[model samples]
Target: MGEIKNRLRKDLTAAMKQRDDFAKSTIRMALAAIQYAEVAGDQARNLSEAEEIAIITKEQRSRTESAQTYADAGRPELAEKEAAEADFLTRYLPQPLSQDELVAIVDAQMAATEAELGAKPTMRQMGAVVKAVNEKVAGRADGKTVAGLVKARINS
Candidate 1:
């Protein structure tokens, strides 16, 4: 198993020993998700770090969506639970890039592309810019959010 997976298992055991219901449940869920992927893939090997991140991101996105839906339905308690679980998952994730950091990445990408093309890139070049920026900021920012920032920068 991956190092993160092992660590999570250890943490889960500790949570169980300490009677931390939230932590125990959250970690168990993450572990189950990882195991499910491995079983589905029919691979004996563990997930790579990137694969782990992808799995966690998928879970986090679902939790966020559920929280939003619950809140909209006037279920604040359930929404809070979902949001808290999402935050717990995020503790295992790399810190998300700040707006300033994202801006810097976008600026660097735009400059590089401009220098290479000898012209300011148009909206049509948004895809290329976003692709490059994602490569630079992978695991630190969401692709869709980064793409939006890149598009706005190009248009500006």
Candidate 2:
């Protein structure tokens, strides 16, 4: 099993022993999602750490969006629950990049791309830059944030 998968299992056991209903359920849901991903194709296989992280990130994003929707619909209780679940899941994710860090990464990637292509990337090359940045940052930053930064850097 992957390092992350082992940690999740351990944490789930702890949560269950401590009678943490929320944590237990949230961890269960995350494990289920990981299992689904493992069996998603023509064959069943264990997930790598990167794959596990991707699954957790997807779950966290879903919870965040659901919480926002619930809040906007005036369902504070449900929203709070979803937010709590998201916060719990975040424990398994890498810390998010700060605005400054993200900008620095974008600047570095842009410079490298410029050097490679012999010109600064145009808005037309935004996708390539964004892809490179996403690879560099992995799941530490949101795609929309990275895209926005890439767009601004390209235009400027």
* Residue 90 miss distance in model 2 (angstroms): 0.8
Q: How many backbone clashes does candidate 2 have?
A: 0
Report residue 43 deviation for candidate 2 (angstroms).
0.6
Off by over 4 Å in 2: none
Q: What is the TM-score of each candidate against the true structure?
A: 0.89, 0.96
Query: On a 0 to 100 scale, what is the lDDT of residue 137 in model 1?
Result: 80
Enumerate residue pairs that collide in model 2: none
lDDT of 1 by residue, 18-128 (tens): 999999999999888988887885466678977887788888888999999999999999999999999899988878899999999899989999999999999888889
Model 2: weakest 10-residue lDDT segment is: 1-10
